[model samples]
Target chain A: MSDTKRPLSPHLQVYSWSLEMALSIFHRATGVALGGGALLITWWIIAIATGPDAYDQFRTVMSSITGKVFLFAFTFSLMLHMCNGIRHLFWDMGKGFDLGDSRRSSKMVLFFSVFLTALSWVIGYGMILEV
Target chain B: MSLRSPLGKVRGLGSAKNGTHHWWMQKVSAVALVPLTIWFVSSIVQMTRADYEVVINWMNSPIVAVLMLLFVTTGIYHLKLGLQVIIEDYIHSEGSKVFLQMLVTFSCVAVGTTAGFSILKIAL
Candidate 1:
């Protein structure tokens, strides 16, 4: 009885996905994730203010494998959000609204997000390890 | 032909009074955060290998302190605005929506204040 295939509203499942759509959703997801990252940073600041011992403890935890992984993900999320946020600002100004430009900008956002995250991590590790 | 005044007609259906202000602040903060975030990430990377005292010394600089204050303030403001929009979009229940929005606001304020205080405590 449930197998009847009458016309129904075009929900997310019914529609084909595009890069633009995925990036738009990702922008919001990254924004939400950044809130948690902000809290983590705030905790770091507080630890620093507490004392050397507290700061060392904080650094120890954050330098661990799991914490490093989370930090890397947070870096990528921030990069994506930052890149797409600029794209959004351009759109707000009535620029890059054309189909071609919009798609191109979305591709650029993804590319830069990955590129910047990698660059940042490389620089970060290079400084930390003096490599 | 309607007897109601304009205000009466749109009393419940009218736009929220601060919609434009909210939208404008979000955009303004987004613009400000672009440079601030870049500076922050670069600074953090530079300090990645520094010890606690060295990090504290960096924070003690006047320029660093001021920028950190600005970055945390603007970052928290943007986070609150963005989170509010997400909650409004996804949370259909009016009760939970209001609750979540208030929670986001309070948390952002608390985080911002704590960060600002720490920065001040170290920088000054």
Candidate 2:
């Protein structure tokens, strides 16, 4: 007789996931990942303040394979979070509520985040080449 | 012994009167971060190849320093708010939720203050 007693609806097995759903999960996941980036950036800035030796050690860690992977993931996460954030802003303005528009925007967010990540890395290496 | 009207209690329990302050500021910070992030990512990436003197010189630029300051300050604030919402939603224990809220604040303050000071030390 109670709504609370009813079996939970839309369990994972029951629901066919959508891009919007996946992106929603990624939004929060990336939020958490970027939190770690904050820590890394803080150490980096402090190292710069401490001068060359500290920064040299910092760069050593950054150039390591694990560090490279982390940096790549962190940058990708930042782009993804920013892209989804723009989608949310649009939602706030009372636009893109329709199913078709929501689907289109979610796909666009995925595309742009990946594109931006690749672009950043491309120019990033270009900077390295100039040195 | 209840003296309050039904409507008063109903309205009182909801809407802390701040209205959409959190929602609006999250968007504002998000908007600010778009350009800031672009500059920062590109700058830091470039600095990777440069020597310490060059890096310091880059940070020494007035425009670079100011943007870095804005980016870190607003970025951390936005992060704190976002984490609070996540923790509030997923952390079922009240104790953990409050603890996390404090953790987020303390870390952001430590990071933001240290970073801002670092930029200032270089720029000034």
Candidate 3:
């Protein structure tokens, strides 16, 4: 490998962001995040197998504020990816091909993911209502 | 493979043959993951307030264990396929692409094995 940098493609400044673009990018981004999230699942299972003490330690880490934040992020990513995956399935079936419809679906995914994530947390914490 | 030369056939290879299979499996696995993911997230959300024993007891169920093992396997497989596409597209270095591909495959196997084993151990 030679120590030389080749010319880069026109990117950062050339492309403007749109909902379609954002959804496409976030689909991949969240997909990547969810990949890393698998390790956390793995860790939890391993802790269970080890014994009660290890499981409690796992719970402690998971119950921390930082862990809660990360968990929320993971849940949000999962929801986003899921919504987009459904959109892709529709696309596969030759639906939602138009720009207007695609954008609409993208907006729907955004709103639905946020709503579902919030609802999940509400249920998890047993918070029926909060002002 | 269709209408290939005798030598090409003899070499047991030619242009990419399994692209369709790869694409199909990704789609199938993606579909499989939808319900599995819903089940998984709901379970985790419920476990947030449950004690360790409760969580273990939940995992100890035959239905839960088998489904979870299926979910982890399918999810990890899907994850590897998605990342492989991204890596193949963006990573310019041939060496890096091959290395990342191997790493992803290895990690998927290791993760699936450990997670499956643990779930089985607890359930059985």
Query: DockQ of each candidate's interface versus the true one?
Result: 0.73, 0.64, 0.70
Q: What local lDDT does model 1 show for residue A10?
A: 73
Candidate closer to the true structure by DockQ (higher is better), 2 or 3: 3
List, residue by residue over A20-72, the lDDT tens digit for candidate 3.
88889899999999987899999999999889999999889988998888888
What's the TM-score of every candidate structure?
0.89, 0.88, 0.88
lDDT of model 2 at position A129: 46
Give the Cα lDDT of each candidate.
0.90, 0.86, 0.89
True contacts kept of each: 0.81, 0.62, 0.77
DockQ of 2: 0.64
- Candidate 2, superposed: residue stretches over 4 Å from native: A1-13, A126-131, B1-17
Best by TM-score: 1
What RMSD does model 3 have? 5.4
Per candidate, the number of residue pairs that clash is: 0, 0, 0
Off by over 4 Å in 1: A1-9, A127-130, B1-13
Instruction: Assess the local accuracy of residue B60 in candidate 1 as a C-alpha lDDT between 0 and 100.
Output: 88
Candidate 3 lDDT at B38 equals 89
Best by DockQ: 1
